[model samples]
Structures are given as C-alpha cells and as structure tokens.
Target: MENTHGYIPSALLAGGIAGTSVDVALFPLDTVKTRLQSAQGFWKAGGFHGIYSGLGSAALGSAPTAALFFLTYESVKHFAGSETHWSPVVHMCAASSGEVGACLIRVPVEVVKQRAQANRYMSSLQVLKNTVAAEGFSGLYRGYISTVIREIPFSFIQFPVWEYLKKTWSEYQKSEVEPWQSSVCGAIAGCTAAGITTPLDVAKTRIMLAEKDSLLSRGSIRYALTVVHKEKGVRGFFSGILPRMMWISIGGAIFLGVYDKVKKTVSKYYLKKHDHIT
Candidate 1:
C-alpha cells in the first residue's frame, strides 16, 4: 500500500475532480433544495429553469472549491498521520479544516445560487452587483455561521463513517481496488449526515435569501429556527431534505468513486516511476 503520510499531488488533483464532479452533477438538486427551503413557495420561485438559475457561477466555482478542500484535507491528513496511519481524530480534524478552507469559495457561490433559486436575481452577475451595492462584499456571505454549523458536524460524521467503510471493505476483500465500494460508503455517510443537518441547512437558506423586511430576514439562528417552525411547523425544518438527500447520496458516491480512482491512478504512476529508477 502507498504510504498515506506523504505529499501527493494526485490527492489534490483527485479531490478537485471529486468536488467539482459532485457539485456540478448535484447542482440542480441543490437548487431544488434551496428553493424548497426558501420562504417563497415553488411556483413563486419559477419553473425548471429557475432551479438551475445560477449554474454558470456554480460550475465556475466548483473546481477551485473542490481543489482547495481536497488539497487541504489530504495534506492535513497526511501530515497528521502517525507512522502507520491517522487516528479518527486526525481524520475528523482534517475534514473540518479542508471544509473550512473550501467554504471560503463555497459561501459566495451559495449566496448567488440560493438567491437565484429563490428568484431574487435576474442573473448571477446581477446577484453579485446587487449584493455588493446593497450589503457590500459581506452580503455574499450571508449565511456563513449557519453553513459552518451545518458542514462541521456533517464532515465529522461523514468522513469517519466513510473511512470505516473503506477500511472494512478493503480488509474483507484484501484489496482497495473497489471504487464502487467507496461509492456505497460515501452514499451511506452522506445520507446520514444530510438527514441530521437538514435543519441547519434550512436556516442557512432562509438567512441567505431572506428579504430585508421578511420574517426570514437575516437574524440569529434561533430566530430563524423559530420563524421556520412558526410558518411550516416541525415539517419546516426538513423542507429540502428530500432533494438534498438524493443529491448527497448520489453526489457522495460519485465524489468518492472519482477520488479513489484518481488516487489509484496517481499511485500507480509513481510506483512505475520508482521501479524504473531502481
């Protein structure tokens, strides 16, 4: 097995590919999720095209966000690894760190995307211009805290489960060559995490797309929660859970499957180079 403690360009490359793949593939579902979670109902939010309103920006941002996240995640995990392997704590921390870094890019994309999903923007560029004009640069990061609250617990749960599944599969099969196994692991991990964090996600969407005078306007997390509950009852907390879960389950599988494939390819390329040297 290749040592997991070394700097590997392939890890960075694979992560970018994985991140972009999932985000793009899942962007439509993500739009649907954001729309359902919005204060505005679906018809007011427009039809099929509205669901993909900010895809241009989403596609543009996906690669870099994914790249940064994977690069940070892989590097941190490797550096934190012991002679043998990383402990569970190391995996969690690395995932969190990677996510935090990726969030820098993700938040802006989300702001634009969610606004579009809510029918708040005529176009992505208009979203940026208007946000800047009204709320300044900071407006683009409307749901920063809520996003972190949602994402951290998600990574904490998702990565550990994913890692455990990968290890189990490898140990039983005596090989790590199974990309489909990684996909299944990813799907399970993502579904569990997405379900748990649905409330936080709802709040984040509300905060980001809320109008100045609306009940869902930018406010405290508790206020947002109370507002959603008051309006939609307990079911409000899970408005977008359906599309979100589908997006996450399939997206996770695709993301991990691609990452594993690229990592394996990179490992083989280096191994071949080393053999030639010897």
Candidate 2:
C-alpha cells in the first residue's frame, strides 16, 4: 500500500457518503427526536409520519453538509501536511473544520426539519413558506448560533474519540478488522459525544422549533434556554437524551464503519492503479 498522508481526501469522501446514508436511514428517528426535544407540554401527539415529516428537507440538506464536512477536513489536513500519528489536537482541528462546514450548510435545513417535526399539520413547503413569511430569509437560520455552539464541541469530541477508538481497535485485531468493528467503534464515539452535548442539542432544537409569533422569539438561543428552564427545569434540557444517544450511536456505527471500509478500498485501488501505471 502506498503510505502517504493524502488519505484525508479519501476519509472525507467516505465520511460524506457514509453520513448521508446514515442521515437518510435514521431520519425517521431524527424526526421523532426533534419532536421530543421541541415538545411544549406532556402530550406527545404525533405519529410516525408526524415525527418524520421533514425528512425530505433533511435529506436535501444533509447530503451537502456531509460532503462539505469531509471535503473541508481533508483540505485542512492537506494544507497542514502533517505526518505525525493523528493527535487529539489535530483531530480536534479537523473535526472542528468538518463540523463548522457541515453546520453552515445544515442550519437552515435543520430549521425546516424541526418545524416539520414539531407540527404534524405542517408540510415541508408549508413550513418553509411560513418561516420565510414570518422571519424572512434570515428566519431560516434561526438556531444557527446555537447549532454552531453545540456542533463545535460536539465534533471536537466525536471525531477524535471515534478516530482513537477505531485506531485502538484496529491495533488490537491481529488480522484485518471487518466493517462491523468499525461500526461498533463509530457507535461508541457517537453515543459518547451525544451524551456530552445533549443539553446544547436540546437548546438548539427548542430554538429552531419555537413558535414565531411568541413573545420569547424563536431566534434567541438565550430565550430558548430561558423558556425550557422555566417550563421543564434542568432535567428538561436532557429530555431526549436516551433516544438521541441510541439513535446517534447506531447511526454513527453504521456511518463510520461504511465510510472507513469504502475509503480503505478506494485508496488501495487507487494506489495499486498508480503503481501499475508507474
């Protein structure tokens, strides 16, 4: 195998492909999750479709975010051109870059998704129109500040933990590990990160899902926190922690496992082909 550190591109491409697949496959769960986070009272009225209503917009938004995340991370790695075994600092930087790129693309779509998830009656287009009318072009980005705040730390933990776990696991395996192993590692990483960031995640969800006309206002992250704290108390901030952790872990496992395997396969093939040409 041609051992060069240009593998970041391969990693990014693989991550994007894997992430998009995971997002689509688990979107129904995500819809439910958002609803759970954004719920106003004890009543959980929505059915499966109600919960998953905004999946279409999510799909559209997630694909690019996933792609951009990996692309940005890879570009950063290439620019840095470091050969040292990936350190926590390096992984943190890479993850931060990846997440920031993804979140920038994802925030508006996330707002749409949350609206669809929160209200069963609202169609994706309906929500989009309502948001535009109520809040204008800027309204679509309601929870962006919270999203960025949550995602930066979330990515910092998620990527490094995932890389470290996978590398550690790979080292333990005497022979080449299967994709399943990678999946397991990914799941662990996802769960760990989700647990750490659940409060912020809830805050972001509330900010996006809040009613536009309300005095509290939908755009203010502080307002969202204030509302949740007033209504639900500190425990409320962790409302969807269980489901979120489960879903994230499973999704992470599948995403990372597939991504790592695909990238490895592609890099191997590319290297072999290059040698043949040489």
Candidate 3:
C-alpha cells in the first residue's frame, strides 16, 4: 500500500469529495436535526418542507471546510510520526487542529444555513445579507466558539476510535483496510461521538440561531445550557439526539469511506506515474 501520509493533493481532493457527498446526500436529515434542536418549535422551523433550505450555503462551504480539515489532519499525523503507543494522542491532536481549521469556514456557513433551515430568513443569501447588515460581518460567525467547542470534542472521540478500529481490523485481516471497512469503522465512531456530543451540538444551534441582542446570542456556552435546561429539563440536553446520531452515523460511513477510496486512488495514481518516470 502506498504511504499517503501528508499527500496534500490527495487529502484536499478526497476531503472535498467526501464532504460534498455526505452533506448533499444527507442534508434533509441535518435540516431535521437542526430544526429539532431549534428554540423555535419544529413546525415553526418549517418542518417537513424546504428541507434543503440551506443547500446553497452548505454546498459552497463543504468542500473548503473538509479540504482544509483533512489537509491539516494528515499533515499533523504525518509530521508527528506514527507510533502505536502515541497513536491516540496524535490522532486527537490532529483532529483537534483539523476542527479548528475547518470551523473557520464551517461557522459562517452554519450561521447562514441554520437560520435558513429555521425559516428565520427566506434564503441563504437573505440570511447573509441581513446578518451582515444588522450585525456586521462578524455576525456570520456568531457561534464560532460554540461550534469549535462542539467539533473538537466530537473529533477527539471519533478520530481515535476510527483509527483504532481500522488498525485492529487491518491487523486481524493481515492487510490494509478497504474503503468499506474504513467506512464501517467511521460509522461506529461517529455514532458514539454524536451521542456523547449532542448537548454541545444543541447549544451551538441555539447560539447560532439566537437573535443578535438576545442572551443566547452572546455565545455563552454556560448560559445556553442553562436556558435549554430551564425550557426542557434533562431531556433538553438531548434534543435531536436521534436525528443527530442517525445523520452522523450514515454520514460518517459515506464520508470516511469515500475519503479513503479517493485518497487511495489518487495516491496510487501518483505512485504509478512516479514509477513510470523513474
């Protein structure tokens, strides 16, 4: 197998493809999950209709966000030097870095997308326009801190689990894992991470969807949790857990699976071309 570590082109292309595939394929589920977690009731969030409300924003952002994430992730892992003893730590650090980079693009896209999904605006363009007009460009990043908080932990759990599962399976099989196997591992890891991080996700959604002058819009993670707890008790923390888990599980399979497949393909092609040149 080719050592695809730190392969910038492969990482960028694969991550972009994977991100677009997962987001586009499972967008409706994401909309459902977002609406479910909205302070606005589901029906008020335009439930069961316009499920693709924010497709434009999501589609535009997915490629860059995912590309930047995998680029950072692979580069970190490559430079860190792979050792079984330090694999989990390496993976966690890499994933955390990846999330931070990805969130630079992701938070703005999410701000527009979620508002559109919640029917607070007519379109992604309208959301962008109104947000910038009223709250300035920074408004597009209203939930930046909350998003990074949610994403870092999710990646912390998911990436290590995914790598461990792949390593174990590869060892058992006496070979590198196939894309499908990687996908299965990703699904399992994603489900676990999604369940554990649902509350953070809910808080992020509320913070992003809050009015500019509202308390939640101030982006206090503590305050967001307090409000949700006040509104729905313990259950509030787990709002949209089912859909979140479902979406991530399925999305993880496709995302990591496709990423492995594309990366492997591109890496092999490069190797072959180099061999021919030599």
For candidate 2, the lDDT comes to 0.78
lDDT by residue (1-278, candidate 3, tens digit) is 34763389999999999999999999999999999999987888988899999999999999999999999999998888656599899999999999999999999999999999999448899988989999999999898999999999999999999999999999999999999999999999999999999999999999999988999999999999999999999999999999999999999999999999999998888878878888
CA lDDT of every candidate: 0.81, 0.78, 0.93
Task: After superposing candidate 2 on the true structure, give the runs of residues whose Cα lies further than 4 Å from its correct spot.
Answer: 1-12, 42-49, 81-86, 174-177, 213-220
Candidates 1 and 3, the one with greater TM-score: 3
After best superposition, candidate 1 residue 122: deviation in angstroms?
1.6
Kindly provide the TM-score of model 2 when superposed on the true structure, using C-alpha atoms. Answer: 0.89
Off by over 4 Å in 1: 4-7, 82-86, 212-219, 274-278
Q: Is candidate 2 or candidate 3 better by TM-score?
A: 3
RMSD of each: 2.3, 2.6, 1.2
Candidate 3 regions exceeding 4 Å error are none
User: What does candidate 2's lDDT look like per residue over 1-278, in tens digits?
Assistant: 22443466676678668877988898877876776787563246375556568877877777678778877776665666433665667778977878777887889888888787777788888989998988899888787778988998888988878777766776787555678887888898899999989888988887777667774445566777777888899988887888899889999988888877877887787778778888
Top lDDT hit: 3
Q: Judge candidate 3 at residue 127 and give its lDDT.
A: 86
